[model samples]
Target: KTRPVLDLRPLPKVMADPEQFPKVVTNLLLNANEAIQKKGSLIRVSTSEEGGWAVLSVADDGCGISSAFLERDLFRPFRTTKKQGMGIGLFHSKKIVEAHRGRIEVESEEGKGTVFRVMLPVGDGVREDG
Candidate 1:
């Protein structure tokens, strides 16, 4: 099992669906875990504030993803790299983020690693880093 390194930073509150938002975190973590192809790999989960957005990022030093798949099929339903995956996790995660008026982004390099970032606007219109 690969253990995740956590860097949970404090941030201003954001408007989010309590139930749906958690699924996004869970799905991203699971995907990161599954991507590991070697022992002693690292998965880092972190939170921070950037430009009035509350960001939650999950990064992994795992098998990574192909540029083609990352660009064309990442957030699409039923597209997956896993043999047993049904592939709805990221699809629903994107929907949930968008529903909260947020956005999701990804960066991956095959044989290197991958990172997924979820960003939502600050609810009270406060900026943590001014």
Candidate 2:
């Protein structure tokens, strides 16, 4: 399979913790890559705007998360599908988004794909450069 690709969309200025945001994205991207076991799988990252917020999404074409896992406490610390995983990625990601007054959402199907969307407010008082 090809390496995961990131499609960063143009975005408006927003206040964010520069240090933490990239880590959040990286974690998600890494997780997506790890999920794919064979060639031809794809991971896409994109951005957009909606309702006065900057929306970032990372999508992967791989074995999707189960409905039970999605509905349960999947984001809880130490909860993970991987035997060696600590299950803290989503939990930490949610905390980072919330710290910026944003929200983290997920969409997935059993065999199709999974998408993680992060929405952060865009406006004055936010530092876009960082």
Clash number for every model? 0, 4
Query: Candidate 1: where is the Cα deviation over 4 Å?
Result: 37-40, 124-130
Model 2 segments more than 4 A misplaced: 38-40, 125-130
lDDT per residue as tens, model 1, 61-101: 88889999988999999999898889899999999998888
Q: State candidate 1's TM-score.
A: 0.91
**Model 2 lDDT at residue 103:** 86
> Which candidate wins on TM-score?
1
Question: What C-alpha lDDT values do all the predictions have?
Answer: 0.89, 0.83
Distance from true position, residue 99, model 2, in Å? 0.6
> What CA root-mean-square deviation does each model show from the true structure?
3.2, 4.0
Native-referenced Cα lDDT, model 2:
0.83
Candidate 2 minimal-lDDT segment of 10 residues: 31-40
* Cα-based TM-score, every candidate: 0.91, 0.88
